[model samples]
Target: MTLPTSDTRVETTVTEPGQRLLTVDGLTVSVGGLTLLDGVGLTIDAGETLGLIGETGSGKSLTSRAIIGLLPTAMDVTGSIVWRGQELLAASPAQRRRLRGTEISMIFQDPMSSLNPTMRIGRQVGEVLRRRGVPSVEVQRRVIEMLEHVGIPDPERRIGNYPHEFSGGMRQRAMIAMAMIAGPSLVLADEPTTALDVTVQARVLEMLRQVRAEQGSAMLFVSHDLRVISHVADRVSVMYAGSIMEQGPTVEVLRRPAHPYTKALVASVPAVRTRTAIADPLPGAPATPADRPTGCPFRTRCALAHDRCVEERPVLRIVGTDRLAACHVAEEVSR
Candidate 1:
């Protein structure tokens, strides 16, 4: 199938609220001559949830790490990561350290691994406040309050327990408490519910939303599950091979995906009410960043790929009122 590309520009009508909190422009990450991320860019508004969804090895977690300056020194990153109008990439290590946990925080995928086994739950959560010169008494009080707020029963007693003492759900909740205890302007949640059961996952997601609402924090929620993204994200960015395939408001992107990769993802989401299975799950494993195709990274697996897709890489362009897609046939797919 040969799908024609659209040349006419369409103005985006989606009005994003709040001030611009982050702008990642032309972000490229490389390690040992392998480009992990290729010119990836996105904007996050204050108090907005930008869901980053992709399969494993799509560089979703890497993007978050780059933003937070968590990447190892060996990896070379060339990009502009602007946080609240300041270029984070250019910021000093000490400056970044101060910004981390205070202006920005992250909730890792596995709480068990993220939390120090030797440290007490209260001390871990209170560490952020303690570092900022908050009185020991106030730090203890806030730690207990945050623990209780995250649905941990008997905060006073449980605060003294170690990571092994808390249940999986409770451990995840403790991680959430630690992330939000500082009341950061930005929060990066990398699959926070990955290890939890469905019931616990639901509660954790709800708690995350509640905490975000209370703190008014902009969040970068990364996950491979579209269903999970649909519930928690206000906007969605679909990534493949370290490149953004599509991005827009969550509702529109989920309901009417403009990119073939996104369509495949939406198709793969099993329906809950009817319990319908995905008739055609996407074929082939996702492309590796090091071995990406010259033109379109997804062209090998794309059904509608034509000569144009094989010869010319398509950059993200306006496909709908608010959507941007990188596929040459994005408009055709949307129609």
Candidate 2:
């Protein structure tokens, strides 16, 4: 699908009357009786970026998939996904189809797979424009312009190239261009730069931030890298065992984490200039949803674990101004 050239400058503010763009409330996903996401909730306001950060099995990607209605049919999903005050989970397939691309778009983790292998890069991008009823000639012109906007050199010449023709970094940039070309109200980026080199990753992150800002788009940026989240997101949610352990402003949560799991994650990030020895890695493997502990899922790996943590699950509680943490000892941890 290709976006129309004339529609390139269309900027839509998607906030509800309360200024909330999207809200996931009490969302749960279970596959074959094994839960993948358990009562996860988060929100993104108009033109704001919310970072979903956690280790590989923490249900970060699952949460994103649920929002976009991309989860497998076999998965048993329960909960509400509201976008602009509309319940998305209850929306018909046709409605979701219409909402996708024009209202919401996703930059998938793997650019190679997300893009059509047989289609030329230009056509694939133009397809989005075409879906919006763009004329063929205009699609081609805007495709090249978008390619150039993403920093692809000599886009007019490379427009005919296939996905394999572009380098890894370029492919990622192309994915970004495709996602943002339509000026979606919300953009969900699922670890879009995971496969790129650090230099390329930085560039892609910068491009994502710049394009989203220019388009006035709200973004849900999913990543396992706290460093990346710190650079791109205004606020962040830390997930563990399919639940949000802590959430607050990115700077506050990164600097003074109120949850034990969040603290461990911060400690694990390597310091660039300091000569300090490597910190002790978090103990124990991440728990699968099916095998989660009786009470706090992170209790098994947390040093602050006590009888209370084993007997009762901690609900998200106010820990500071605009901060929430699901830890029994959040006060002690923050101190």
Pick the lDDT winner.
1
* Full-model lDDT, candidate 1: 0.85
lDDT of each: 0.85, 0.84
Q: Model 1 over residues 80-116: C-alpha lDDT tens digits?
A: 9998779999999998998878788998888888899
User: What is the lDDT for 63 in model 1?
Assistant: 97
User: Candidate 2 lDDT, tens digit per residue, 170-199?
Assistant: 898888878877788889999988778887
TM-score of 1: 0.91
Give all TM-scores, in the order shown. Answer: 0.91, 0.93
Scored by lDDT, model 2 comes in at: 0.84
In candidate 2, position 189 carries an lDDT of: 93
